[model samples]
Target: MRILVFGGNSLLARAFTASAPSGAEVRIAGHAEIDAPELLDGVDVVVNFARHPDDMRLPYDPARDVDRRLAKRVSPLTARYVMLSSRKAYAASAQWDATEDSALCGQDVYGANKVASEAAIRRLLPADRLTVLRIGNVIGPERIPGRRSFMGFMLNTLADTGEIVFDMSPFVSRDFVTVEHVAAQLGRIVELGLTGTYNLSSGTGIMCGELALAVIRGHGKGQLRIIDPRHADAFRLDVSRLVRETGLRQTADEIISYCYNLGRALG
Candidate 1:
């Protein structure tokens, strides 16, 4: 079976493709060509990971545009379109864990755009054939703990410097997932030909302090200066819908350990 994977160069896309069967037939389409439905002609699945043109930052903007282009290519196409969206859409702008049926409120640019993009895709394909994965923050072997992806960045910095300060409140309640798990589920989704909105997450979350200490313990180094930042709102995704449908669950500790080992290898 041949599949067309847009966002050819994204890290997440790379993980998905690399984890596919060794002999799977896959074609990568550049973001520049996504609007041309011919890019995926004769394809069975189109996994879009593009960024919006407006995103100028090195990685974030480019990824945002990939999805932007994806929203454009849905019509007149007959392939299965699976979009990777974010958990930000339901955040309370502070802290919240929302079920799939919650009243969605898109706050950030990333969240707002994903909400818009999902709307566009659903308009073209019914919820049955079109899949929108509202995903958690993803971590991998190369995750640099001190970089600006917020949590990862801060932790890495503290590890490097041996000491760092950060404001922590009632510990944000967001989950982090691993790419490997996501890839496995993506394959299953294709096998079943099922489509619908689902939350793909770690199934549990770590408080800010817990996440920080985990980094320190996993590396056997660093001192975290936990500051008292007011209770920042966070979003917890209820992935039970996905669990019931796909039978996917995750142990946060295992995923966190994977991050540590991957970081060790990179270093």
Candidate 2:
């Protein structure tokens, strides 16, 4: 199979390329390089991992509308198109485990962009030709310190001062999936031609305090300071569709352990 991946420099894109099938021909391209539509010729699948939610300077509507148009252009060129979305696209509610059918009432600009992008893809491509993966918190080794992600912040702070600080309560829980697991499942989804939306997550939640402790233990020494003790709501994704379709299992302990070790190694 011939596969083209946009966002060659992204963590998730790198992992996916590494985990792709041995015999598959994969080409990596950055956003600038992908401006040439000829690159998609004879490509069996196109996977887009390029949207940036961390850029505060970029306005929401412009970014989202651009992505929508890009999706429309790419949908007709390939046999299969996969878009990486975020779990943040779901509506804020007391619900713990959200499924694919949940309301997409994202209020944040980043989340709203994802919703708009998903809607655009669905509108442009046939159901069978498009696959949307609503991913959760992806944990992996990152080279740069003080990046925008939670793991990035924790790792950078720990490495710099041998301490980690949390302004919020540690009891807050969130779903986290390893980059390796995400890569493996993405390969399966592409190879098997699975379409529609699926939640890619650990299918379980982990407390912030527990995750911090694990990181400290993995690093062999670090202090965790919590400014506020008030607990926050726990949120997890219902990944039944992923398991039923791909037979992939995610364990929280293992994922967290891998991330902690990766952070320590990077540090």
Candidate 3:
């Protein structure tokens, strides 16, 4: 199989390339090449991880729908199109996990954009030729602890002052999956020619406090403190479909271990 990946610089793209099947030929296209029609020639599948140039810009503009534009261009050239949607596409329903059939009720701008992109892609291609993956938090070495990301803020604070503070309780939970797992599952999905919407996740939730503790323990120091005992905006994805189809599953323990090892490796 010949696969072409856009947003080649993205962390997920790197992970996918690293673990791509041996029989598959993978080519990466940066922002410049994404617009080149020739890049789509001879590509069996095209995975898009690219973000619109206007993403997160203060004055939001719907006209800058890059995902839709990319889809329109690539759908005609490639046999299969895989879009990386986010769990943010779903609203925080504290009651239950989100399944592929769940409503796209998220109010966040980012999530709304993903929802729009998904709709546009679905309109452009049939179910057999398209795959939409509503992925959860992916943990990996994409960002160093001291960088400007969520993991960076937590670990940096711990490293600098030996204390990690959170506005929510430690029990505030969310789903997290390893980059390796995502890469592997994506490989399987592509090889099997599976299409349709799927929630790509570990099917479990991990507490925020527990995550901090694990990283702290791995670093061999640091502490955790929750300032607010308020309700947690927790969410989880129902990955039964993914598991039934791909035989992929993950545990909280494994998620914690992955974070711990990441912390240790950062030192």
Candidate 4:
């Protein structure tokens, strides 16, 4: 199979390329490189991982940009489209795990952007030709602990200073998936020509404090300091579809271990 991936420089893209089937012909390109019509020729599948809804600068509207790209660069081409969406697109529901059928009433700008993009793709392509993957927080070897990202902040602080000081309670939870798992599942989905929306996650939630402790344990040392005693509610994704279809399962501990190892390697 001939696959074309956008956002080639992204960590997930790199992971996907690395984990792709051995015999599959994969091509990686940035937005600039694949903007032309000729680049779409002979492509069997197009996996888009590049677009960000955060760029609200002039002449770069997220919804409009996705529509324009699809209308001009992708729609005319004969390739299946796989869009990488975020779990943030689901409205906040503390009582239940968000599923594919959940309401797409995301109030945040980023989530709204994904909703818009998904709508546009639905309109532009037939259901059989489109596949949307609503992915959770991806943990991978490429992560670097820093203030910019939550995992980074926790892991980096603990690894570097041997202590983690969190302003919020440690009870906050989120679904985290490993990049390797996502890449492998995506490869299989493409190979099987599966369509429709699927939630890609670890099918479980992990507490922030627990995650910190796991990372520390994995590192063989560190401390967790929580300044706030108030607990935060947890949010999880209903990955039954992915599990039923792809048989992919991962625990929060597994993800934490992966992150810790990556941090150790980086250090």
Candidate 1 lDDT over 154-240, as tens digits, reads: 455755676546675636656777778888777677666768888888768766566666666666666667668776646567778
- How much does candidate 4 score in TM-score? 0.88
Report lDDT per candidate. Answer: 0.67, 0.80, 0.80, 0.75
How far residue 15's Cα lies from its native spot in candidate 4, in Å, is 0.5
For 96-190, candidate 2 gives per-residue lDDT tens digits of: 79999998966356676778778877888888788899888888775475586878788888888888898778889889888889999999998
Report the alpha-carbon TM-score of model 3 versus the true structure. Answer: 0.91
Question: Which ranges of candidate 2 are over 4 A from the true structure?
Answer: 52-59, 62-66, 230-233
Could you tell me how far off, in angstroms, the CA of residue 245 lies in candidate 3 after the best superposition?
Answer: 1.0
- Considering TM-score, where higher is better, how would the candidates rank from best to worst? 2, 3, 4, 1
Model 1 regions lying over 4 Å from their true place:
21-23, 53-68, 91-95, 143-147, 155-160
| Number of the predicted model whose TM-score against the real structure is largest | 2
RMSD of each: 3.8, 2.1, 2.2, 2.8
**True lDDT of residue 20, candidate 2:** 94
lDDT winner, 1 or 4:
4
Q: Count residue pairs with overlapping backbones in model 3.
A: 0
Q: How many backbone clashes does candidate 1 have?
A: 21
Residue 204 error for model 3, in Å? 0.3
